[model samples]
Target: MSLRTLTLSLLLTLLAFGPLSAAIGVPVTPATTESATATEAAALEAAREYTASLKSMTAKERRTLKREQRRAVKDALENHQDASTNTILLVILAVLLPPVAVLVYEGELNNKFWIALLLTLLFYLPGLIYALLVIFGNM
Candidate 1:
């Protein structure tokens, strides 16, 4: 079975047992009884839907779906790695020159760059810290 199928199966198992377990040791008032009945009905409906979907799909379709999921995950990981590398480079530049790092990160000479320049002129550590915070916190 695929990971998704296994996960859903586990979920179904939990849902099936949840109401029974809740009723086992607790006193069921009318409100609690109604709540449990609703929970059970919802779980049954979900199981039916899941089983129906499974029956509807062919093996080929399932394979295609899994392939698409894998591709999406791979693309996301690649994008995350690229972002981390860029952040690291920016951090290094920020430590060396705060105003220039802000300008590069902002992709223009914006007000942020001016703020960094002003901070750097007054005190080096404050500007470096501000540039680092902008690069890290914004992400």
Candidate 2:
């Protein structure tokens, strides 16, 4: 090919890749080592303050606080119990029903919902075990 034709081809190729290379700006260097140490120290100080606050509360005060919190929760739940329960049930049904319906219509019981339900029941066993552990520890 002529020099002009070769030069034009090279220019076109560079032009095509020019925007891509230009888009990749300078690489970002990480924060200085001193700044990282300061950040870690700050986080540790905040956690220590939080733990100190928790440790400052007396057992009786904590129990009374928890009891009041539970009473508030109970009152709120009582006020909206039926509506909340129905809404949760509806959401669960909506999520599980469509796939379940399809499975039943197809005469298949091996769907993900059945598997998930079984797994959830099985997972509750661990929670029961943990409760037993806590109960026996207190005895």
Q: What digit string (tens of lDDT, one per residue) describes model 2 on residues 20-125?
A: 5465875768999999999999999999996787689999977887899899999998887464454334333323333333233335565544543454356533
Clashing pairs in 2: none
Q: Sum up the clashes in candidate 2.
A: 0
Cα lDDT of candidate 2 equals 0.53
- Candidate 1 residue-wise lDDT, 1-139, digit = tens: 9754564465456544665658487866566788899999999999999779877999998788879989999998887757866876786688678899998899998888999999989977778778978788776
- Please give the range of 10 consecutive residues that has the lowest summed lDDT in model 2: 127-136
Judging by TM-score against the true structure, name the best candidate.
1
lDDT for 134 (candidate 2): 27
The TM-score measured for candidate 1 stands at: 0.47
Instruction: Give the clash count for model 1.
Output: 0
Where does candidate 1 stray beyond 4 Å?
Answer: 1-60
